[model samples]
Structure formats: C-alpha cells, structure tokens
Target: MTPTDPGQQGPLVEPVPGAPAAVATLHDERALVIADYHAGYEAGLRIERGVDVPSKAESRRERLLSLLERTSVGRLIVCGDLMHSIGDPGGAERGELEVLFESLPSKLSVTLVKGNHDGAIGAWLEGCEIVPGSGTRVADVGVCHGHTWPAREVLESRVVCLGHEHPCVRLEDEVGGSRVEPAWLRGRLEPAAFRGRDEYAGLEWLEGDPARTGSRPVESPAIVVLPAFNELVGGTWINVAGQSFLAPFLPAGIARGEAYLLDGTRLGPYRSV
Candidate 1:
C-alpha cells in the first residue's frame, strides 16, 4: 500500500500522541487542508423537511479537533462549504460553528474559502479571513472549493486543492462484499482528455482540448477531495466505470486514481488506477 510515486509521502493519516488520526499532507508545512464540512447540514435538513436525524455536530467537531491537535498544524484551510446553507447561516449552523471554533486552540489560524453554500455567511464571518472563489495560494498551492471550474487566470497556479462534490469509491473485500470509502484521486490533464467519454459528455465545458485557444483545462491541482466532515453519507465514487460526474474533476482519461485507505491508526496507499 505504499505510494508508487517516490515523491508522494505520508498516507492520509499520521500519528500524534493524543489524537486518533490526522490527515497528512502531500506537500506543505504547518498547514492542513480539508473540504466540505457542511456544518449544520442536519439542522438545515430538519428545518426544510422536519426530518428527525440525531445531532452529530459535536462529535464531528471533536474528530476534527483531534486531527488538528495531532497534526499541530498552525493553519487550517477549509476549501469551502463550511456551512451547508445556500444563503444565510441558520441558528443551529451558527451555534455549531461557534462551538467548533471556540473549541480550537487559540494558537491555530483558520481560513475559509467561499463555496456555493457560503452565500451570505460573509456578514456572519465579519472578522475571519475569507477568500472568494478566486482562491488563494499557500506554499505554492492553489486552493478552492470544486463547485465550478476556476477561471483560466486562477488555474495557472501549480497545484490546485479543492472540495465540493465529496468523492468516494466502492471497495470489494476478499469475499466479494463491498464498502464505500472516501478516496483521493490524482491525474494529469492532456489534450482533448475527456472527449467522447460519456461520464464527461454532460460537462460540455470540460470536453474540448484544454490547450486549444479559449479552452481552460480544469486539472486536478494536487487536488484533495475530502470526506464529508458532517454525518451525511453520500459521495461520488471515482473508481466506478461509465459516466461519473467526478470524471471531469480528475485528470482526463483516468477512470480512477491511487487509493489511500485511512484506518484509525494507519493510512496505506493501494494502487488502483
């Protein structure tokens, strides 16, 4: 389960004395990037439909904090969608975020990149640093939430990290049983990469040769599609065949990328692509 690329170091998880697991970095120092937290999503669902799901925000926060403490990362960059509301922060969402933030060690710095779900949270996030879709460069890497392709100007950066569509892949055990696990996929963009591919046909914007004049390639920027930090359990699997919505997000023509299975104490990379 070691990575094929010698340059690719660290499984998704690494050990820290008091924390159960920490998301390791492929590149970067004193920084950790995570996406699609969707804070207060359950409460939002309840308000919208009166569904009765148990509140799990506190536990999720504890897990995130444990990772943060374990990594001892000086900075935490949320690619986008810190809250699940389309426009404004709901009472529950706000309260949960408040609790989560308050629980963080004062030594840590937090940054939020606005995703499609962060529409009106700006007012609520008065003093916190917020980056719009334009994105930010950290340790020579570009980061954004992957709801839409970045403008050509922004894509010029060397590495792009993002989140939005929570990416997962189904894995079959030795006995033929299956389970869905969160995955990280990486691919290199080539000319006309997704042409004729049914999974990517619907994404007309991604079909043509990126090198062609006026066609900007939406490549995976050392991209890291994080598991949903919230309790909701649906995601797009990159390993499946056919027209996957995630096809356009990865490097063109690659049906799947290497898989890093994250167990509580150990993270191992299994070559799947």
Candidate 2:
C-alpha cells in the first residue's frame, strides 16, 4: 500500500488506474477499507480435493496488517467473502479462520459485510459487524460485495465499493502475450447500460418483503471492485475486447483511463493510460 499524498486529486489515479486497489478519501485517511479477502479459501480447496497447497491465511493477515500500518487507518472494512466455504467446515479451513481471528486486535477495527461465501461462519466472526447486501454506509460511501449489484438507494451513495468478480486487467508486452493483474475500475451508472443483460435482471439480496415494491433501481454502483487478496490467481479482464462479463459497465475500454501500479511502497504511474 502506498501512502496517499495529501494533495493528490483526480477521477482516477495513474499507473494501474482500474486495478483493484483501495483508496483513501481526502477527508479522513485513518478509515481504510478493502473487499474480497476470501481467507482460508485455499484450505477449502485442499479439503474439496486431496491437493496440498501451502496455507496463505497467515500471510494474507500479515499483508493486510502491513497495509493498514502504511495507510495509518483505525478501521478496516472487508466488503465480503471473508470466508470461502458455503456452509461446510473443513479442518484446514477452520485452522485458517482461527489464525485470522486471533490476529485482529493488534491491527485495527475490522468489519465484514456478509457475502455469498460467508454462509456458515456468520456465527464465528468476532470484533466485526456483519452488514447485509443492501450494503453499509461508511462516511458517504456504500460498501458491498459485487456478487449482486445494489438498488438505486445504495448506488446513489457517494461511492459504491465492491469485490466479487475478482476483476483484473490484461497488459500485453512487446511479444504480445499478456498478463492479467487486479485493477480498480470506476465509472458512473447509466440506466441503459444494464437494461438487456440477464445477469443484471434482479438483485440477489433484497431487504424487505418480496411483494413490496415500487421502482427498485438495481444499478451497478459507482463501484470500485477490489481484487481477490488470495494468491490463487485467476480473473476476468476488464480491458479485453468484446468480453461480456464486464462489457455492461466497461464498454469504453479499461486502459484508456488513468492507471496506477502499486509496487510495495511505490505506486508508479502507468504512462500508457
């Protein structure tokens, strides 16, 4: 995590513009938030199959704590998917969770918004508040996990941040093969953009009664989709030509906008964008 300069301002930061990095507002720098941690996911995979993969739970915790230290935040909000199993409890997964739960207090206040993956672990979360997908209001921003888009009221919040698609953008080198890295994508909502897509047909989680209705606007929020913190490494690239998953929102091409590449303590400006 790069320390935010007090004087930076723009619609997007440069280098890896649409990359899935967290942002700090000009007002309060102490409250830092991110999305889609998916802690213990590797352990879940190992249990589902016999494959042995090194546990990443501790490293992920350490990295997040280090990032918090760099950001100097007093609180951390995980938009969703803090756990991987839908409802089953695997031994390795349980151990990973224990490691994470035991390490929180030394860092900062952490909050986990219930995501689709957080099915059973809801009862075990400590030192964190669980918010529904109607989303939670932090300052003026709305935080949600993008497994489902939010309604109009949620979108209208100052900024809607989410994580779920594990969004990444591809960058090709001179030889032509490309590498996909997590990106932070940003764009305002236009009603017409989501009109015809079956994926955007309905909200996955609605707060009130099913019969209760008026015009519920399920717009894609002015979103900042964070990348998966897991090292398993796979994603949908936002910059690819004719890609459908992100086409509804990123039609204009992800690379044409500003980009910032996060390299440890140094965030370099990607001049191409």
Candidate 3:
C-alpha cells in the first residue's frame, strides 16, 4: 500500500509503506513507530487453537527490516505490546523476541512504550529504554501505548500517537454481510471533555509551563490511534455504536474521527460507520 499523505505543516506523521495496520513513520524525525507487534502470536494460536505454527521470528524480522530499509529510519519507536502474553512469555515467544531484536541493526535506536500486555517487558530487552506508563515525547509528537492515562509531557506535542485499542472499522455489504479492516483514527482532542479527569493534568501542566513547548503553539493536539501491526489480533470497531473505547481520552459519547484504509482510502467520519 502507498503511504498516506500527512497534510500538515510541522512534525508530520504519515502512514508508511506498511498499511491497513502498519507502521507510522515520522517524516520530520526520521523515526518509525509501530504498534502491537505481538511477537509470539503463533504461540497463542498453539495454545488456544490447538494448532502448531512454527515461530514467526525470522519472517517478522525480515518484514521489519524491509520497512526500515524503505524508510531508512535510524530509530524505531514501538508504541506497545511487542509481545502477546501479558504474563510470562513462553519459551517460543522469548526466543522469537530475542531473534527479532538481535537481527535489528546495532545503529538503530529502539524505544518501547509500556503497554498493559507488556508485563516486565524489559527482561527481554536488556538495554532498550521503555517509556514510563504515561508515555514519552519525540520532537513535536507524543507517543504512547494507550491502555492508560498519558503523562503530562505527552500532551505538549501537536500530535499524539497511540496504540492498544487496535482500532478498526466494520463495513457492511448490501447483502447484509460485514467485515472488519484495520484503520487509522484521526481526530482533534476536545479540551473540555478532559475536565476533572486525569488526562486534563497534562493540559493543566501546559498552562503553567507555557514555555515548555518553546516556539510551537500549544493548541489542542490531534489524536492518531494506530492500527495493530500484527494482524493476528482482533480489533475494536470505532464506528460501531455503543462500543467502549479502551483509552479514556477518546471522544466521549459521540461518533467521531476519520478512518483511513491501509491503502490510503479515506473512509471519512468514522462515526457513520
């Protein structure tokens, strides 16, 4: 799929060659952001489905290398859930994780945002820096694994990138059949909606530290919820009525945001489903 055009002036984040639930590559930062790698997905299938699939470490590694080669990015920012199991990873899962990271170029800087499913993820990656539970910032962008409240620093960015909801859309055919496809959700944050909530802390902190953002105007930032990188996991259809969002910061009680297909199709106003 073609990369989606990020039509903004500063600190642009665009969907890269991997699409329909792919990597989010930063144009200005020369960095690549991906979510929900779930490295040992085959292990889950083995346990749950009673089906034995070989470890996908080599294939997944090769795929990621191709994306890096395409983007030529020096940094890889994993939003979260690099592994599937929230508890201890099985032997196959651990081996896969080791193989994947070991294959990465030593020159690359890899950052992982702690996700709810990432219990003691550091045991696998000895030196990689894992951001706090709230998330971290890179230039004018904020990155998080989603599942929880973002830290005050994450709000300073003009754009906030997150994962964990595995956002998607359900499309119904005229024949009354429906299918789900991974999608990107882009929407502006309403500051008023955050009032009295923990998320409003970031906004409040920005109030006192007006100089924190330097020259960039600290307007309400846009939220970009990424689709899962691994297709094995199911998704939450953002357009489906009465669907509960995993992230507390999401639009409350409203059909909102635009959904884009992996091939750069603008699904438009996701609220309409």
Top candidate, metric lDDT: 3
Please report how far candidate 3 places residue 119 from its true position, in Å: 0.7
Candidate 2, superposed: residue stretches over 4 Å from native = 1-21, 26-29, 151-153, 193-221, 242-260, 263-273
Task: Give the local distance difference test score of model 3.
Answer: 0.75
Worst 10 residues of 1 by lDDT: 13-22
User: How well does candidate 2 score on lDDT at residue 69?
Assistant: 63
Ranking by TM-score: 3, 1, 2
**Model 1 Cα lDDT, one tens digit per residue, 153-258:** 3344344556665756677888999987665544333325435545435443445455665767454323344555554846676566762554243444332345
Provide TM-scores for the models: 0.71, 0.70, 0.84
Worst 10 residues of 3 by lDDT: 1-10
Cα TM-score of candidate 2:
0.70
Q: Across residues 120-226, which tens digit of lDDT does each residue of candidate 2 receive?
A: 67676666777775466665567777666554445445556666666566788899988766655444445454455454444333132335656553333344556
* Model 3 root mean square deviation, Cα atoms: 4.5
Lowest lDDT 10-residue stretch of candidate 2: 10-19
Question: Which candidate order results from sorting by lDDT in descending order?
Answer: 3, 1, 2
Q: C-alpha displacement of 213 in model 2, angstroms?
A: 26
Q: Model 1, which residues run further than 4 Å from truth?
A: 1-29, 151-154, 174-176, 190-221, 246-256, 264-273
Number of the candidate with higher lDDT, 1 or 3 = 3
Model 1: lDDT equals 0.60
